[model samples]
Target: MRHILSGIALAAGLLLGAGAPAVAQNPFEPVVYVNDAAVTRYEVQQRMRFMQVLGAAGTDAAGAEQALIDDRLRDFAARQAGIEVTDEGLQTGLEEFASRAGLGAAEFTAVLERAGIEQQAFRDFVASGVAWRAVVRQRIVPGISVSDAEIQQELTRRIETPVVTRVLLSELIIPAPPGQEDAAMARAREVAGSGPTEAQFAEAARRLSASGSAAAGGRLAWIDLENLPPSLRPVILSLSPGQTSQPLTVPGAVVLFHLRDTQGTLRPGAREQVLDYMTLRLASAAEAAALAARARSCDTLYAEAGGAAAAIQRQTVSQNAIPGLIATQLASLDDDEAAVVNYGGSADLVMLCSRQPALLAEAEAGVATTALADDGVEAAVPDEGALPSRDAVREEIFNRKATAAADAYLAELRADAVIRRP
Candidate 1:
């Protein structure tokens, strides 16, 4: 089931009239309206207040602007699909938020106030949050699917990737008494050339080596190749298994490494999986709309094959199959609004599908088995555990770039709108 979770409200500054009182709110003067609902000044302020309280660092003006836009988009999507966030949903959200923050709901509010967040304004923020998430899942998630090959490729890449392990040793050098520079060099050369055993090195460091690591026998932990300083990296990389590096000098001291072991260098390949099933064929657009209309209470609408019941069907299909949209927007559905998604047009709608991966060695454990029996011999389904192919990543990149396009498109929408500033 799509969980309708609460999100932070989008904030935008209001255009104030010269003679208007500071508290006056103008609903007609649009700050931003996603699909059509007014995003108010109070909503924006509460979001800002929360940002300040949470010490969130990335709230630049452009980010804030886009957040407001996304807020509207989500709310618009929800409304278009006839999704609504109820009072009980909001209360549950409040409790969830409090629990996440390690506070009681009442205590969380008090904390917000202490952080200078006003109560009612925070409420609007919560409401908008709930509403926007409703929109995202209803409108966007159905079209998203991951493919089996992509999952296999990702698994292969992850499993086959190699890691190089080396034992790194660092030392803090204490310059030998000035006149003893040549003697120090002699000792340094001896240590470098002798290849003393670790215990021998520790003893030599204690008696003759002028380094702080004398106490620890100059031992450093195993180091990943990536974290090595650039100057010593070439030396480290040149060494093979059971090899030690020549002494490398830094500004004041020297660093050394001993190549120990290497692991992983696995090539890419496919993985096996098993999954359960529920597929809802809302026969028509009318049926899709009808399902949306019947949705009411969280469990009630989802109980039998009602408007929101598809999610329950999905859950029954497989406990592991969650709504694929993992971002804040899709998670807020509260089950009811999430279950009845309005997929317009004549295409057969499938809802409440879930999967569980089966052991590869076991018979009949393959991705193709999870494919819709009616979808023909070759239909693609995503393996959630795998990396997407290049096309998929490219598509994701394109979708992310959509907001700018959406903004440009909306500008035309605004030009056509006969909006008046109040």
Candidate 2:
């Protein structure tokens, strides 16, 4: 399996246009160009090492196959959209990765180095992430869909099985001297409400709270309300934003909460969406210009061919069922229109056109079962449920359903794409 993974990696290396570089194989040169861009063996090795450390270090014959497929898809994407990764974007990515892993930039690099990964390779990995995500967003996400019933179902589930909403809070818990518990409690009392508003709580925490987060303000993060200390949950949730709770006795000292906000871990009913679209192909700059020209003569073509020249290829897709070319193009369109367009670009020219109304109706009908399910969520609502407004729920359902449909449509596209691997 590892060997298979390595083979796939090797194929990816080739697809990236990796080659040996140098005047006489200049030892100082660490990079080589694939296509019009430069990449280095150093970069690949570093990325591989990072992958290993990140536990993403696996490959098999199937892995190799997937890599080849991805490479071809990426090539098609690059040519279609003229996508390029930028240095600033790469830097931003590195910073984000480090932040997510709870490390400073320098510390993150140090860890990578300790793990035998090089900086350049890490950069390549970041760049690859940016490119791949772009492709997914561009070619896949737009055509995904969800239905109203899905949102309702999710909401209903949440109502039925509510998770305790807890505020995860941090305080500068100053330990009192053995004999000074009373004094500390007195001080805690003076500081509770008058000390900090939720927005100002961090500042107060830094200045007066006795804990580790003094430097970063009191950031409690996500805490489950049910799991909180018995005396803490009510105080935390009842206080409005910017309000502070009364000091309460705990094992060590007086504790209080500066309410930040409230969040619910509720899963409602099934959600759904309606998707509509049309697609066209423009393979080059000439083709884009010719679309207008062809449009002018469209009447003649319609008379001779029994349909517009554009009629040769058109797609109307639901949230769950979409054609691939249209799916890729839909990535650029709005939620309501992503699946209902013709999008093709000549090597340099790309155009996405809207779908016909009839096609949209066809898509809606096909995905109606899913859509109705999303819509029926509210009907299942219990009389005792204290839910948000119907409009808000409806909006959520619409967004979810549309997104789901677009996703299913894109999957179909990927499955049917005519990819040729080298």
Candidate 3:
């Protein structure tokens, strides 16, 4: 689900043209009923407009109706659980969410108002999310646990042992404008099947291809065959260098790929490590060092730093994708190990909560080389580091289990609700 706070900014852009005039709204007219609660037509219309503004796929009246129903269900469940978001808490949440777009809450709200969205409507949307989160934490966290054996099993499953094949491919995409799909497919078939030589293909691409690569004669960076759409993978693998694929009709376009080269390599999952970590930026090096010395685990840091506000950030990312300085600092640390680094007048306390080998997708040879270079890992020998700590694996497993439980619980709530549309 899209975060409510970020959705407001996106919806704001959509409301620019909607500020024409306000129609007198009848807030009491029921559009739908979930048990005893009534969802007003005014609210449904507002939600539908908001959906359109967010550019949601297939954002029609039907989808908007269903979404609003779900929101009502969530709101009902939250209220039953006594999950009320205080005014101060809601304000703080709005400010924190606005900070993601580098704007203050007041400034962000002003933009939304200019776009014709009511402040109360935005607040209601955010309140539902905050309340839902609280309910999930209260009802779901108690039953979740991760064992050492389970963590080991998860780590073992993530270590890939497959040999992947990569290809250097050139693409040509012919756009199928409304009512022109057949013509585009015919053109693609002709080009793919002996209609164009290599030089002719390049010329045709420069002239007729609709993709950005048309400017470069349809040349694409190396990509793993597996990375291509599932339907295209088998077709691509069957073609030899200098051969082209049959016209494959995709959404809005018909595509063709000219195989230029292929290579087989054993790429392990060692490069794919998900790191759950947190960074606390303190006012002084002395303060940071003191915190680091006292903190032994992620839980300890959370307890001590709860009130610091904006000075702490938590993230989960592939190890190779983290910033170079932090990645280097964390390279040798075990799970739950803390490191304090002083840079630019602030002291940063970094701790690792968990690490696990990641399930990696196939990539073209050139793409793999670039990724390895970025991670400061040699492509030939990617598995040069020590095994991830058990504690990190356990954390990952715990998170997965908790998420699954929460999803199931929400599904149950929706299924059990009495829903009627009139």
Better of 2 and 3 by TM-score: 3
lDDT of model 1, residue 418: 41
- 1-422 in candidate 2: lDDT tens per residue? 21222222222223233333333543333343333333333444444445433423222223323433444445445456677778887778888776655666576676666545567656655665676557666766566555665655555554454444655565646454444544554455556635566556677677766777778787777776667765555556656656766555444554556666666554332232234433344455454445434432323323332333444443444445764554465556543222222234332122234333232233334522122236565444333224444466667766666556544644554675654322
Candidate 3 regions exceeding 4 Å error are 1-28, 52-58, 161-395
Winning candidate number (lDDT) = 3
User: TM-scores across all candidates?
Assistant: 0.35, 0.31, 0.48
Model 1 lDDT tens row, 175-199: 4342333234335545645666555
- What are the root-mean-square deviations of the candidates from the true structure over C-alphas? 24.3, 24.4, 19.2
Ranking by lDDT: 3, 2, 1
Minimal lDDT window, size 10, model 3: 360-369
Local error of candidate 2 at residue 262 (angstroms):
27
Cα deviation in Å at residue 11, candidate 3? 5.5
lDDT score for residue 293 of model 1 = 56
Clashing pairs in 3: 224-364, 354-392
